[model samples]
Target: MRSLQPSRDVRIASASGAITDLPENLAELAKNANVDFIIGDWMSEYNMTTRGSQKVTNTDEAAFEQQFVDSLTVALPDLAKRKIKLAVNAGASDTKRLHNKTLELVKGAGLHLTVAWIEGDEVLDIVEACKKEGQRFRNITTGQFLSDWEYEPIYAQCYLGCFGIAEALKQGADIVVCGRVADAAPTMGAAAYWHGWSRNSYAQLAHSLIAGHLIECSYYVTGGNFTGFKSLPQSSDGTGLLNLPMARVREDGTFFIEAHEIPGRGGEVSVNTCRTQLLYELQGKRYYNSDVVAILDQIKIEEGDGRNSVYVYNVGFEKPPPTTKVGLTAFGGYQAEIHYFLVGLDIEEKAALLENQLRQYLKGNFSLLKFTTSGTSTSNPVSQDAATVDLRIFAQSKSRNDLSDANFLKPCFNMVMSTYPGATFAVDARQALPKPFNEYFVTILPQSLLNHTAHIPALDKSVRVDAPTDTVPYTFEQDIELTVDPIDLFSLGPTVIAPLGYVVHARSGDKGSDCNVGFYVRNEDEYPWLKSLLSIERIKELLQNDYNGKRIERFELPNICAVHFLLKDHLDRGVASSSTYDVLGKNVAEYLRAKHVQIPKKFLDRGRI
Candidate 1:
């Protein structure tokens, strides 16, 4: 880590995280933001299944995200005019179609721009071949063998590294479209291409990877979904919460994040905002990517010198993981859910009565039947709305006919008159129709087995991007344990029974069926207390209803004063298939925060969170 020559400064601005995210802002950002590259992330575990479903069910329609195409239609002219290169994982399941569509857009606009695409992420054939060769492809979270998987997998996609993107950018491509590349690959690729970093530049590449991960979700790093969301400032128009994020990366791979300086843009980038994004969807301290494994325990976030800016640095790294992660999706079954509102008196009894009635009246043989009650009716009359809670009935079956309105909804509808006092269902008769769901399985495959390639249409050339030659087989057990001096809760003085959010900021996200919840404190002195209070057993108790003997993994980021827990199989089969109310696990932190905890009374003196 010696002082080296300064490299070209690259400013990468993200339009959005998903295809549906602020599509209108792309043209404005491209026209105004003085950025070198503009990128967007359109793929997620849920998105993979959805996009794959489109390709499978309808071959006539373009399988890629249409919102991205519409956004590009407006932004492409500005992008070409400004020479701001664009890169996005908008291809989803069908990258080539998106690439061709992009080429068509460029041609139709009467503009000349070289568009490139990275393929080989779709590996259904490879997966089938490997399965035939005795690769069990066990589910990473549940340890279930793939042979036992009920749904037949129609699509398999491996996460690609940034090298393919870097090659495309280096080969004079003005735009690059990718399918199932690692979410952070664009930023890492842009930085690597700009800085000419070598593949063996593990530390630097690792830092770039971290930078990409931070900004990959657009505004997530710039106060969006922040625990301090109430503190977000109002835009010039007096409306609040509209924000865009950009990363200014240096040659050293260190970067500062800031909200796009567009007039009327709201939100701020602070240490906490960056810290929250850093802790999101992470499993352990060492974050494994195709390019390099980022050691995140030592990474630090600080308030930058400029307004609404946060600087990040000190990210350590090792060689890349020998295997790259892959997501295989399959049609699980048809699922239908019904909700009923129970107002006032004996809510629990009413719920029980409804469940019993439905069980007796149900005619279908369901694979999964779940009853979820959300919210607690407040005691002592305020408003009738305040005295109401929702009881949801979720039913899943392999046969769609079994979950139709007649079989599933009729039984619940049958209880309308005979059930609890003041009973009413939430949905209309038509809304109760069953819909299909997809099961997502996350596993890893040796990088050597992948045929990662980049296709440059302008040059009529296809380049093979080889997997990392110098890779280390990484395991979570190899990560060094972080040591923190424990704080004695009894010695911290009188405790108050209150919500943990009083002195803590938390964020949670899903990875396949697993969910990660990270808790962090603002003051450095409170780190030990926060760490000591949230033990694995305490977490299980807090998430008593959700835990259900699920495996949990805990890790710490001392630099950010954060503790993160991974609840395995907490969301059942992930967003697409999970019948849970909080299937995405975005509310897990808020749920945990609402749980009453014995907090140091002194901390309560800091005032309401």
Candidate 2:
């Protein structure tokens, strides 16, 4: 059998956009000669919950994602002919089913391909045994015990590392299917397998891990979903759907990240775009992945020679964790929401009246009821749409009967005839129907408990991979205090009070229920002021309207002139169960940027602001 090119350099590309991203992009990825391997991340916290529910309602074969198969079918023939391997976590909860289906697709196309699947991330049995042994699966976000949940969990899985996938590839698999592994595990596994890196090659593994993290969201490292997106150079198409990102990784662990340079492709890759993704979902300086713990404080990014390219380097890593993180999803309850539009005069008064009516109608039926108003009504209305105010009310309860649309939405609809004139429903009435709320529980299981294995049907053999027995214990520590003195505003010549977006770029995301906001500046001189101005206290002040006295931790990445804040329990119950309008907290940083702040005139004078 032929092998990959002798060159130690490998180019890996990510085609999956988000957990719910379409797979059509894989067709474009297969045409690139520069790419040796392609990875698609098809699993997210919410995605896992949905897949788990599907598995419960149907057979294991129905648990696999068909979109992945459909997309792979479009690109499989091309990839096979080019000898480019594909890896994806689209298996969700059914790795074996996905593997078999992929094999059938390959064979049906008159192509002989080797397919492999990695498993053992599932821990339902372990969770059940732990429960029997009186072990409590505590909620990492709310600090509640699993026994407190209203419904038993449908599924439980742990985040595995890259070694299993690496082993599968080493056995000559053309494609690898994986269950719930770290989003970057496939990329790290490919790099390790290609370079024959030692399991303890902390530096190389860490670098590849960072690279995978950067491109895992496909074009996110490009201009997609970026706060500084307006600054990106436009393409001929004038659209922001930039070509997905691909990385040219060398054996030495250094890599150049850039998007496919097809003509008219949207999105731009630069230091700012890279910086935005580098801190996208980061919690603090210490980022934990199953493969290695990357110390992001010293990570650096620079412009690459290629068009719209950036180089990421200097990522440091420590030993792997002794236990892998486990995520368990339980049915919290039924949740229902209704949106009411209040247009015309006396908006505030109408809003108050509506809330009072809802409270009276839903006196004690729900465990949680929240009424939030969006789009303020101004004096002297210009237009009906402009004057319209949105009143969003959500309710959750342990009883499905309690959260039904009759109990939640009927009251609002019934009040429309009597309360505030011109009050009407803003969204489709179907949205008022109750839906299952999945509560997320995170914990850790010893490595020895998981039975990691890789199977190749062509060879009709399965290989059991042993967990690392020499894992090092982890010690928790408080965030490092800022040593640099705060900058004196008077030292600068003049200042202006404006939105902070003028001087800084920010990106925010959610990790379970915690919100991470990363803020960075373009000018090095402004770094001092940014660090001093956006302290923990100042951030809490800016978000004071939404602050709920939750724990917050701050960390600084001087190499990128950025500060990251982790807001614990800020997203309520996370995406699947959160009652907030912005469940992912993707707008947290944008909200901060819109806050009025004193900006140094010298920095703004550069005209880049």
State the lDDT of candidate 2 residue by residue for 451-486, as single tens digits.
888888798768887777656654333374563578
Off by over 4 Å in 1: 1-6, 476-483
Model 1 gets an lDDT of: 0.85
Per-residue C-alpha lDDT of model 1 across residues 248-365, encoded as one tens digit per residue: 8888788888778667767777888888898888877788899999988788888886888888999999899888988888888888888899999999999999899888889898
* TM-score quality measure for candidate 1: 0.97
Each model's Cα RMSD: 2.1, 2.3
TM-score attained by model 2: 0.95
